[model samples]
Target: MATQNARKQDPQEALIDDLRDVLADTEAMIDDVTAQGGEKALALRGKIADNLRAVRSRLYDAEQKVAGKAKEAARATDTYVHDHPWQSVGVAAGVGFLLGLLVSRR
Candidate 1:
């Protein structure tokens, strides 16, 4: 069950997870660079900081977009079910039947 849930995660969740890994790596690199005292290192650190900020901004925007799309999809589904309750139930039953058949085959 846990593995199934993990596999069913939304694309946005996957993206956020990957970005978090990248951010952690960048922070570790920054820490390592701090030990080296030199003008070049300082410049490199500044560049890295700028890149980190840009990536953070992009991640935030992507999160918002994904949230918006999810909300929109939910709203559409709600409206459809409300407008055609019987049809929705029929569709749900058909899907369940198909799933049961597939599972029984295994």
Candidate 2:
């Protein structure tokens, strides 16, 4: 039960953890660079920037994939209804009539 609770955390919690780790490391690097002077701090900053960019790219790709899948599903549904207009209309009407009958009885 404990494991399940941990596993079922809101998905954003994992991203938040990752961002927190990155921030902590960045803070540490900044402190180190401040104490030590130039080259090492610049290198750490560059690495942090690269990591952030990669995370952004991955997020963008995921969004695009989800949108594409949604559009494809909508198109497929539209095509199916177009191909079976009478059947779809009959089914919808039957459902509506049944609901109306039940409501009137109550």
Candidate 3:
């Protein structure tokens, strides 16, 4: 019961938090560096902006792809369940029984 209530850090969530920290640190560094000079600073700023835009676009595309794959998997699962309801129920019950046995042993 205590273990079930404990919060778990998912690997994907941890990676996202780490990425956010890195982007925040990079933005801070860029702000500090761009404050001193003139034309060169302006050019650097433009380059950074363009690179950031590209990164954002790529991230968007990857996110969309992941979402698409998940949707496809869901559709497949829905189809299977619809086509074999009894088999699905049996499989689920078997799995639950196995899990119960394992947990009771623990």
Candidate 4:
């Protein structure tokens, strides 16, 4: 139960950390933009914006990849059950019977 709860919270904690880093980077970028002048500042600003956009795109792609992997896992599980229905059932029954026996012994 504790492990499951931790796993559920882990992504949110990681996202918060990532946001903190991005915020720090943005603050630094702002300082850099202020330090430069005229055309240089503008160019730097543009580059910073482009980099932020690229980071956003990469984050989205990574999320899509994770989702795809989860879907693939679900499909693979489904395929396995379909291909080995009797084997899967037998294994499950065997495990349940062994657990029951252990409990009875206890």
Candidate 5:
């Protein structure tokens, strides 16, 4: 049951978990470097800071791209539904019925 639940975990949740782990490790490394207190530690901290900035920038770009795509998809779907309301309704009802049957079986 635990394995099944793990397998069913959301992709976004998994990504968040991975990000949290990375953040925790980074914090630990920074703490260790601070305790050491040397020029090399300073350099390493600078490098880590740069890498984090780069990662943050990439994540922002990815978020923008995903949001743009989602908006485009929503616009297209809205237009389609408006153009063919009956067809959209039929499709939705069919999908709902199928889902109900699948849930009942499960």
Candidate 6:
């Protein structure tokens, strides 16, 4: 179970993680370059900072929306399972059996 959990990577989560890494690196680069004295550089830096802020805001909003939807889906599934316990069990069993068959064939 632990190995299986580790093996499957959610692509969206991976993309988010990569984006965070890039944002961090870009901010660090901006900070490192801030020491140079130039009007154009300063203006460019300010513009970049503003754009990063907007990107961060949008990313945050997207994360919140995804989280809310996930929570709603979880709640609905829970309600369905509670309402139809036998049906849920039967569906899960069917899925598991199908997976077992495919895995064995491979």
**Number of the top candidate by lDDT?**
1
TM-score of each: 0.82, 0.49, 0.72, 0.49, 0.74, 0.76
What is the Cα-based lDDT of residue 81 in candidate 4? 92
Between candidates 1 and 6, name the one with more favorable TM-score.
1
- Model 4, position 62: C-alpha lDDT score: 62
TM-score of candidate 5 on Cα atoms, chains taken together: 0.74
lDDT digits (tens) for residues 13-58 of candidate 3: 4444445555667677669768877888778877877776676666
Show where candidate 3 strays beyond 4 Å. Answer: 1-22
Candidate 4, position 105, lDDT:
100
Tell me which of candidates 2 and 3 scores higher on TM-score.
3
- The stretch of ten residues in a row with the least summed lDDT in candidate 1 is 1-10
**Reference-based TM-score, model 1:** 0.82
Q: What digit string (tens of lDDT, one per residue) describes model 1 on residues 10-94? A: 8677777678779889988987897886998889899999999999998999888988999999999999999999999999999
Q: Which residue pairs in candidate 3 collide? A: none
Q: What C-alpha lDDT values do all the predictions have?
A: 0.88, 0.72, 0.72, 0.76, 0.77, 0.79
How do the candidates rank by lDDT, highest first?
1, 6, 5, 4, 2, 3
Q: After superposition, how far is residue 77 of candidate 4 from its true place, in Å?
A: 0.9
Q: Which stretches of candidate 5 lie over 4 Å from their true place?
A: 1-24
For model 1, what is the alpha-carbon lDDT of residue 26? 98
**What's the alpha carbon RMSD for model 1?**
3.6
In the order shown, the candidates' Cα RMSDs to the true structure are 3.6, 7.7, 5.6, 6.8, 3.8, 5.0
Score residue 91 of candidate 1 by CA lDDT.
Answer: 100
Q: Candidate 1: where are CA atoms >4 Å away?
A: 1-14
Order candidates by TM-score, high to low. 1, 6, 5, 3, 2, 4
